[model samples]
Target chain A: MLLASLQDVTFGYGDVPCLEKANIEVHSGELIAVTGPNGASKSTLLKLAMQLLHPWEGKVTLSPTNTAGNKLVVAYVPQQIAAFNSGFPSQVTEFVRSGLHTQSSNWLRRLTPQAKQAADEAMQSMGVWELRNRRIGELSGGQKQRICIARALAMSPDLFILDEPTTGMDKESRKSFYTLMREQIDRHGKTVLIVTHNLSEMNDMLDRMITLERREEGGWKCCTTTLCSGHFAPAESLH
Target chain B: MLHYDFMQRAFCAGGIIALIASALGVYLLLRRQALMADMLSHVSLAGVAAGAYLRINPSITGFIVAIIGAIAVEYVRKAYKTYSELSVAIIMVGGLSVSIILMTMNKTINKSFSSYLFGSVVAVNQLELTMMLAAALIGALFFFLLRKPLYIISFDEESARTSGIPVQWISVGFSIITGMIVAAAMPIVGVLLVSSLIILPAALSVRIAPSFTSAILVSMGIGLTGTFTGLTASYELSTPPGGTIAFILLLFLVSGLCVRKIILLASKSTSKKMRPEIAVKESRISKNGLSSNLQKIRQR
Candidate 1:
């Protein structure tokens, strides 16, 4: 089923057009990688899919099959965790536990038992349960990334979007990240859209790869490895 | 210090302002908008002057003006989007300009400010005390209800919005309440020193606190303690209460930084001590195993 779709989408900041007439589709339980050169609007497309931005001229739809009543739960991690730095002053557990506020209806927010359990379980899954009380600023790059991923897992999201999550991680950390990605897909059945420059290292956990190309005049062109075999010989070489 | 009713009222007013400033200050400091209090307080100065000129209660006028300034800040911030501090700077400049004009128009406004200007704890009358009490109670309620949202926003705005938290409304609400609290605190800490009350305690808290909740609690304690200590010290030394409070708060911040540095150094020393001990223990164990292997070879 279609998890999200964007049709004839064109968007820009004032006069500089970034995306034009872009059509994209995401299916349930699929891990899709979005790759592009700088200014190719890969992040822009994900934002539009997440409804963080509206296309200047087209329609964006999410959870088209499952929108009977409840809004789909989405967990979106931006490229940079700007507030996170050494001496930022917060514990890993508190930061992870904040994800449970999404399920809260009360103005006075507290984590319910189930939400707490979910957060703990997520932390355990990410192998950061032992570091729960540690300050976020003291964590390593890989550990911090897991903490953020654990935060998303605690949300029990139907759709997950991450932008350049592997930018600072090493080879071992990237491998562990892929393992976590497989778990998210095979176990939890989430539809994921990842913006990455590490596509060459993204060995086979992906369901699809979408490439965005910046055009000569303005806007961008969207292409998939499968549909345009000529552009990428053997399709796998696109990675 | 406790011999007079005015001293008692000063303590009470000081305690309230300390608590309110501690709570609001932590969030502002975390957001890197500590200047919000400073800017709003400056804007409130014009109101204070206008009130004296017109023979109205200055704190009341201050409250109204600061609230308006906060709203203006929110609007200007939204319009600028990229440079939010620019909005605050503009408002601050405009406020000081208004203050200069008001002061020039009515020289008696300086006398009006004397009661709260240098924080004349001796001058806190029944009306000002009641006003401070009411503002403290209301600010407490607002903080309690908005605590989670505020935490979420401060931690990360993008994640907060994605989580369906009303970041915009919570931010605006928080800013307004902060302005109100600064105005209410004027009589205790004075207009010039209000930002110190808001930022100093929180700075001290974050330096040593292990967690977010503890940071807030520690800040409140530091604030109240610093304020009361300064009040008592002022009475004893015949000094200006506001300047004394500010100096005490500075002392607290300095001590906090020193403590954190000492702890860090101490931990590093202990870990250095443990590393060589671990290495020796491992070497001894390996030597024992080697001797056992040699004994086995001899038996063979």
Candidate 2:
């Protein structure tokens, strides 16, 4: 089943268009990697899919079952880890537990043994279990990224959207992250849509690649390539 | 001493302000916008000065004008998201400028500026206490009802929006609550130090607590303790109560830092001792495994 669909979407800030006429479809249990240059609106596409930004032109729809009839159950890991001030002094466990913000009226009252177990499972999956008691400010870049991913996973979301997940990681850490993602997708069948500018690093792990190109005619063209083809041709070229 | 009505009123007013400030402080610290509270406090000074000039009730006028200033800050922030610090700087300057203008106007009108600047705890009547209590309760209710969305948005706005949390409303609601708390705290802590009552305790708590709930609890304890100490010290020393409270809060913050450092040092030494033991155990396990393998080979 199609988990998310963006039909002829146009998005921008004020008058300047960041993305135009872009369309994409995501299926369950699929791993789609969105890659483009820095200003190519790859992140914008993920934001649109996550419903963080409204499409200026077309409709972006999610399957009702996943959204629980309200919106998609999306778990997003943002690109800029620095967006959070490190000096804020939140514990890793507390930060990860914020994933359950929607599960109860008061977050303090709803932290039962079951919820803790789920958080522990998420931390264990991300290899950050030992760091749960540590402050978030004390963590290294790779560790912080993993903790964020664990936080997103603790939501038990139907779709995980990550923007530049491997931006600041070392080679080994990036490989380990891809291994973890593979385990999540293959064993647990969680759908994922990741936006990254580093195409070469994620080439092997991606099930499909989607590219957003700014056209001379004042819009964006989205082209998708299956893993078997090993190349992303232009949508117009394919037509 | 127990028969003194003013003392009872002072305690009541101080308690209410402490509650509101500490609760609001939690969100301010979490959102990393603690400085905004300070700016709001300064802005409320102008409100108090305006009230004095007009011979009106300073608390009511302070509350109204502070809310308007807070909303203005939010609008400016929204308009300049790319340069958020610029928005804050503008608000700070605007608030300071208005305060100076109002204070000058009050001087021309022969109104005393010291009462608004330093506050008069002896002047906190029954009506003012009632107002403070009402504001505190309302602020508490607003926080409790919107805690979930507030938490999500505080941690990560993009993630919160994607998860279907109303990021915009949460941000606006938090700003409004901050304004209300600033207004409520002004009469007790005064415009100069009111924001400290709404920021320092929470910051100190965040440094040590494991969770947001614990942080808030710790903040409330610190706030109440500081408020009582500050009031008593001010009464004894014949100084401004707000300055005393700010000083006490600063001392608590310093102690928190020292305690945190000591804990870090202790944990580092303990980990150092355990590291060699872990390495030795791993080597011994490897040696035993090799010997057992050799014995099995001989038996085969």
Candidate 3:
């Protein structure tokens, strides 16, 4: 299923159009990576696809339902989100549990037994269970990153939109994270659209890759993108 | 103090505003709009000045104007998303300037302006008390019913949107609630010290509380304590109630910070002494490659 798409899109922060005439599509159950040089508006492209940003021209579509005819659940982890509110007064357990809030049908905002189970499972999976009682502000950078992903994991959404989710993680943690993401796709069939810089590390795991590049056009910097079949192509070949 | 009917009204008004304002402060502080209370109070002052000039009740006009100011700020905040505080500053200047001009137009208005500026215990009339009670009741219901979505949106509006939340509407509703509480609180704390009632307790609680819910509770506790004690002190020493309340809250904030710092330092030292090996291992983990190595081992 087509989860989300941006076609013939033109967007920019100011008067000059930086990302112009860009096209990208996200399919259900596929892990897609969006890579680009700095200032290429890669994050903008993701935002456009997610309908978080309206395009100056053309169309953006996000399917309202999943394959099973249920309301689509989406979890987004924006770039530098851990650093965004580092001083947010919350414990690790409490923060992770919040991801389940949308899933609750009642208006009471009470924690159900199922939500508790899901939260604990997500924390344990992300290795943040040991630090569940610790305040979120007190955690290390990588630890903070893990808990954030864990929070998203607890949501168990149909679509995951992540931007630089591994910024503070080490190589081993990154590797484990990839393995975990693979399990999420292969076992549970969740669609993920991620913006990443580590093309070499993520190349093998991606089903498709979208690359954004900028070229000078008529005295203005304009962006274009290339979509490639990921599993068969090497990361170096794209460059 | 309770012997007087006015004193009873004053305590009731103070307690109600303290709870709602402090609660609203947590959301405002987290959203990086702490100066909003100060800005709205100033804007409400302009409304008061206009009310007196027009031969209307200043409190009613002030309440309407504060809500309008809040909506205006919300729109302006969107225009300057990267520098949201600029909106507050811009609105504050407009509010203060208008109020000053209006106050100058009516020379006799200065007699009542001091009470609005500095606050008086007797300012909490039956009408003001009723307004405060209504605001508090509405504020409490709003907070309770929308707590979950508010938490998510407070963390990150963009992400909250993707999670299927109506971020825009909730944000506007939150602003309206803030305006109502700020306007209601003006009678008790006045324009100058109103924000102290909102910001100080939340400022301290956000630092010291272990979790978000606790932060709200702790702030309310601090606000109630400060309000009651300040009122008592004002009656005893013949001090202005608003200044006395603000001063007490300020003192609480200062002492809270000091106590928190000392406790953190003490805990660190004692932990190091109690578990030397664990401390050494932690340092080594920092020096070496990944803390995930320890995490990995712990996972096993």
**Number of the top DockQ candidate:** 3
For all candidates in order, state the fraction of native interface contacts they contain.
0.46, 0.52, 0.70
What ranking emerges by TM-score with the best candidate at the front?
A: 3, 1, 2
Local distance difference test scores for all models? 0.81, 0.77, 0.88
Clashing pairs in 1: none
TM-score of candidate 3 on Cα atoms, chains taken together: 0.93
Which candidate number would show the highest lDDT if scored against the true structure?
3
In candidate 3, the residue pairs with backbone N, CA or C atoms under 3 Å apart (3 or more residues apart, or in different chains) clash, namely: none
Residue-level lDDT tens digits of model 3 in B162-190: 88888888899999999899999998989
Locate the minimum summed-lDDT window of 10 residues in model 3 chain A: A216-225
Better of 2 and 3 by lDDT: 3
Per-residue C-alpha lDDT of model 1 across residues B107-193, encoded as one tens digit per residue: 866666666556676678887788778878888898887777777778777667776777888888887888888888887777788
* Per-model B-chain TM-score: 0.89, 0.87, 0.91
Worst 10 residues of 2 chain A by lDDT: A230-239
DockQ of model 3, rounded to 2 decimals: 0.61
Model 2 / residue B185 / CA error / Å: 0.8
Give the TM-score of each candidate: 0.88, 0.82, 0.93
Writing each residue's lDDT as its tens digit, candidate 2 over B159-182 gives 887776767766777777777788
